[model samples]
Target: MNPSQPSAPVRILVIDDTPSIHDDFRKILISRGNDASLDAAEAALFADTRSAPVADSFVLDSALQGQEGLALLERAHQAGEPYSLAFVDMRMPPGWDGIETIRRLWQVDPALQVVICTAYTDYSWSETIRQLGSSDNLIILKKPFDNIEVLQLAHALTRKWQLARKLAARMWDLASEVERRTDELRTAEARFTSAFAASPIASTIQYNYNHCFLSVNPAFLELTGQSMGDVIGHMPGELELWPEGKAWLDGVSRGDRLRKHPAKLRTRDGRLRDVLVSTEPIAIDNDACSLWLIDDITDRLELEQQLVQSQKMESVGHLAAGIAHDFNNLLTAINIYTEEALHECQPGTRLHDDLQEVQAAGRRAAALTRQLLIFSRKQFSELAPLQLAEVLDRILPMLRRLIGEDIELVSEWDSGLPMILGDENNLEHVVLNLVVNARDAMPNGGEIRLALRQTVVLASQTARHPEARPGQFLVLAVADNGCGIPLEIQQQVFEPLFTTKGSGKGTGLGLSTVRTIVSQHKGWVELTSSPGAGALFEIFLPAAPVGTVLEATGTAGAGQPASDRHRGTERILIAEDDDVVRNMLAVLFPRYGYQAVLAQDGPDALAAWEKGGGAFDLLLTDMVMPKGMSGIDLARELQSRQPDLKVILSTGYSAELLQQGTTPPIPGASVLLKPYRPDSLLAAIRNTLDAAAAAS
Candidate 1:
């Protein structure tokens, strides 16, 4: 096929009734030296004023019949050395004629050159032409042909065959190369299309001149809350996708590269989304285009804000814990000494009454600090399975009176409701806060309704409320027919310190505390309201698992009267960092018939236990203390030594939170909240000792 190399000899096939014809062709085209006359004739005919005709240029094969010639052509082609020219006699008998033979030859090798060598007028030129269908490969030579003419025809037609073969090979190679390149292009196009459509980054193609969207992938549609029908062939301005950052697009239009340009786009749902838009210049169908990669950062930004808010709340909790610790200690001292002063005075006297007032004020201050701790999630809560109906029954009378006689309070709940695991007191606060807010919404007075029922959240519902999951829940709905909340400010209603009420009229902590308590209980709150319409707040709490036994909410003898309580003479180790709290516990324990030893911190308490040879029956220690140890650590170490040391771990911080994953909790260790009364403290010590005694 390559022309640079020597070509194979042109194969010639002679089909005739006489064998002499084959010899003649050989002498002229193939036989060398013996065909001097033929060579000279060919030279003279072709103007070979050059040299004798090139020798052995043709390979001749003999066939006596048209069928034989056709068979020879087929054999040569199959052998990869096909005959280039076939000379056929038209009047061959007992076999296919020249016309039929030539036609069959062409079917096997259409590129073969054929010449009809006929003496008789078997078929006219018109008839021959009509039968063979005009072809440049066919030629007619008369029977009595001159040697020179024969040589000339042989030389010219054989050269023509060589040129034709070369051209055919070239064309074949060219077509093959074209097909390969086309396949490669098709594969590349498919890969690009697949990758673009499947990319997680929302991508679109826009016509640069028109600024209209040419194509958008699924992620692009999802990010914009639009469909293909909505976006395709539409300009971004027409879709209002870019509410802001048109300047970024303008710069891109001016050939500036847009890389991660921060922008805001309003989705079809009318919510603004934060996004990073990047662009690439490309050409499609010779039309200038731009590729827009949009990274929707709406959820990402919300999560970032939530993380910042969480960190802020954690810092606030730490600060509140520190404040509550010191303040509760001070309150404890004031309340205890005031009670002692009251006991020393007559009930009718001014001094006794004033001490009572002072004690009441101290208690109120303690309550406020407790609220601060609770809002910061540092307050100790006693979690237990509680009947919501029972808790509401006990608190509704107080709530009714708090809302004033002008406002009507209505309550209803489903019977046989499942219990929820939460702190009863905290759940009470949640209800109280919602009811109070409902009351305040209507200055002119309105109806406040409370409804409770079981609810099951489905997976589909979780899409609307991210905090919800498929599970059983108890919903407490609080509805108020009052001036409902405006939609614009609804999201901020639960944020700390956000309020619509005038200064001094509200502290803005009610809903915030409600949110905190609900979250701590592993629940969520949903609000339905519109300005000038009624508002409804629903609290969803997880239901306790079936067959869960309810645990006692209070310790034994928790609310026993002081005069009727049994006194203990057991030795107590009191570990508190606050000097006043430490001294007050030391002085008060002995009056309850309990001997007390004082320690400033956990390490001091540990050292005192070793000094006393582990004789103490109880360890009352602050949960958070200085000197490289905490109350939990002290209890773990002392219980290891004595194994019977009863512990009452106390803290102004959340004792439950502090004890989590710190160590396996000291077995049978009780927790005591700070700002304690003398009676409560004595009762805790007595009950703890009694429990240990009973266990022993």
Candidate 2:
């Protein structure tokens, strides 16, 4: 045995009647000084040339009687350091014979190695085997046996015992590991079950072979509007969930792992829902299955579409506003020149009538440009606190005629509704646009319901719509029972130039303009519709504050006609960027009994003012100008020098638009919109100059 090997010394129990036998056994197995004697005896017995074996390393405990030996073996086994082998004298006469002692010892430790030593024929080998019942642990060793044989038996038996103990220890560790792993698996399964039940995203498990639902979470049940009783053991197709049942089943059967796949499913209530589906293969109780996670994105997609539509409209609005502003400048020149030609030509002449037609066309073109500006939210509105009912009542007759006899028009409103601060004409346009859209939606004729109601909005109601605010509002709803708007296209209906009608049938600006007009009034629009179920468009306008008294819609010249009162002889300075409009104004103003001086832009006007010693009575300048000076800047600089300077501001852009980029028009300054007639410009100039004179 190697000394470096980590093992306890092998122990042996000896049973004998002679004291010498016990001492002999110790000398052969435990005593290292007896190695020389053992070697000489081995050499003489065989006359071999081989060297003696390594000194025996063992512990020996002796008992005089068989019973004593058995007691020693039992004590050693109880102490957890049992003997590996025992030498029992077969002729020992004491409390019990060697055979009886060996039987009891084997019972105590079945793995113990035993050797029966006997010189006399107390029993034959066959009789000894019959007594011990023949075991691998039992060996018959004749008395006076060779010392080498005793040493060999002790070493082999002890090493075998050590290996057995190590094997048993390893088996025990393996058993413990298997138990721990099983416990962990159980814990993981429990956690998975709990999480699956608690998750908010709809989850489902279905058998891989049958494609029938094995389990469904509460969220799945709620999302599909189905109960456990309805969904259990049922295929998705059998439940009528998928819009394309065949396609769904085919994909599932193909083992396709869906990740964020867009799908449409019909609910139990027959409403369609947009969902994102994800699935992966799983196994439950040795059965192959698929785990599905579904997310309902109907509302989210609607909001995203609304956001994109809003951004698109805003961009188009900007472009439309710019185009309208530039176009209005051209219209101004056209209309003014046409008016001048009409004054020059004789009435009832062909030339005069042609000029009148040209003038009429110019007015219509101007109206179209104004509509563009309205859609862009750049049109100035003359907002007033008025009863919406009165405005609607005035326009319903015209609407009834517009929608035709096939369509029945019905109007209803709650009494004592609060007033709104909105432009009457613009509000009328909103109502007309919605009603027109409704009428068009029902080409075969249908009922149109126009309703007005006051509503109080809450902060919580604004979660879905970012444009909504918390306040009281007057809701104007136009509903039609006609071929309804589809859910997929509802978000696009409000975008400019997005029309469902054929060519030349619609401008596509109806709903867009309605939204723009409502937004300009500090309001929002809500639309609800289902396919083949009609559409409802609701316009929410902020209500005027309580106790707000309506003011009379009148001006200083209400008592007299505008043309008669608008003449003035005061010198007026005009600044314009367009040559045609500028020249037209220069010629037109002097004809109205006013002294007119012209400049190309604000800087040129400033130099002219300085050259003439600021003698002009009123400064009429365009809002947007050249040479780094706006109309507002020029007025501010001149007013700084002349505190009582009278000024009139003109622009093709709305006042709201000008305020966003530069300084707003000064207080007390009159704003004259472009494409103006000879009367409107003259009225503005005369009013501005006369107001200053009256103040002085």
Candidate 3:
């Protein structure tokens, strides 16, 4: 016996009074190595005291005994002790025969192996075998049983008991392994649930075709404004608030996986928000489900819109700056010639008064040019304390004339309003543009009100207006009780060249110019309007520190004096490549008392200046001349030769040159923009000479 195996061999006890039966059983047990010690009827009564080691034996001849062998066998089976095998004689005469006794023993211990030894091989024993359910462990030995046959039966029963024990042990081991794996799966599920619920982004799980909600994280619940009980197990589209849910579900159903797709949804609060949704399908237990990840993109969309608007404004500003540069040159010529003609005429003469009007109109035209420059962000701004209320008061009469008589004009100004740091003219343009727009909104006549007041905008308030900054602001609001803007067109109202008015009736640049000017002043514009309700345009400009308003000092018009103009005797070099433009200047320059010298390009201009024998009074050169030699280079060469030579650099686009200062290769030089009238050319020449003489 192995020490590691179960302790003790199975014990068996048998009782019989017949000596011959005992001898036969002993012979069988000795062959099988199972020591069968027979106990006589008297010894069996004191079986506990007889320590000769109880042995398994066949019980026989029960009818001849005072203490029946059947009774002894019954006592052994009822002992509740471990037993391997038993053999009983069928001829035993008692309350139960051998077959019946074996059956009762089986009922007491199904694990106990039993067999019957009988003298007669008859049908009665066969019938009893059938009654015992025909167990394989039960066997019968004939009377006068062979020793080998008895030994074989005992060995077979012992092997059967060993096999049963082994099977039970394997079953318990397999059950434990199954229990451990199930526990591990449960723990993994708990971790997954915790991670999903803790994420900030909205997450959801849905079945493939039906789109039934399997699970949703806390963020999804918060975003949809629904409880877990309300959402779980329901169809996603049944929420009613998510208009695009069906479209997303359909996309998911068509494929096993998908990356992020842009989607717009109406939230539970009825507000439209943009989201990026991604989905992937997973097969679980022969069924498919999808996981959806949602990222909110409302803020990103707004930022894109602002970027588009900024780019549009930049393009429009470039256009405006180009126009203003050319227009200013024309004004300069008109101003100079008109002043000259006025000085040469007698006072009150028709020609003199006509020249006076021309000069006045030129000054107004110059003012318009400055406005365009401001809109294009090309002009230099001198910030000073300015009362917004007072500025609005002065602008009301002009606004009234602009809106015309059909529209009733109204003004409301809060007394002692805070001042703002900005150019007064630019502010006036913003106000005028708003009023004009309002007038157009109501062609049939309506009330237009200009309101001015002091206001403080906090960080919270600035969120609504994308361009607003947190600070004290001078709020200038222009409102009209008229037909309002359509929602579809409201977003594009401030875009350059976008207008609802009929073609030629209004230039779409007005509101765009307003926005540019306001932005340049570090301010923001707020627009509120809807169809059928009036529009309100509010501008918030940063309040300036309290100080005295700086009075701008300058002549009524800044132009050269007529008497000290350059004469034809003074040589003037004109460096312009365009034939028409150069020829026009060539023809116009001599009329202004200057001997004109022409140059087809920058090198030609340099040659002409050197060919003049270094006697030219001024060098008027176009900034961008052909053949790689710019006017600035020519001017520098001329200045080196004749240090006192006056130079005026001109260009169609002077923004880059202007930022480098009003000089070519050196500071403090003069510059004139192109497309100039004759007078502007003369005035520029005269101003250059005056500035040169002043510098000397």
RMSD of each: 5.2, 5.4, 10.7
Q: How high is the lDDT of residue 118 in model 3?
A: 70
Residues 1-696 of candidate 2 have per-residue lDDT tens digits of: 111222466678888889999888887776747457666755675465354324455778999898788889889877777888888888777477889988988888887888888898888878988988878888888978977788777766676777776776777777878889999999998898898889999999999788899999999999999999999899987888888647665776567788888888789999889999898988889988889999999999989987987798789989998898889999998988888788789999999999999999999789778889898878866678999988888998999999999999999997788989998877887888888889998989999999999988999988646699899989999999988888888878888998988899998888888887888888889989998899999888999999987788666667886557977788788889888889888778877788888999888988889988888888888888878988999999989877777888888766666657646668788888888887777777777777787888
Rank ordering of all candidates by TM-score, starting from the highest: 2, 1, 3
**Candidate 2 backbone collisions, by pair:** none
TM-score of 2: 0.79
Model 1 / residue 14 / CA error / Å: 3.7
TM-score of every model versus the real structure: 0.79, 0.79, 0.66
> Model 3 lDDT vs. the true structure?
0.70
> Total clashes, candidate 3?
4
User: In lDDT terms, how accurate is model 1?
Assistant: 0.83
lDDT of 3 by residue, 157-270 (tens): 655655665665566676777888888978887887897899888899888878788899998887777899988989866777467667556778765565778877666677
Clash count, one per candidate? 1, 0, 4
- Cα deviation at 311, candidate 3, in Å, is 5.2
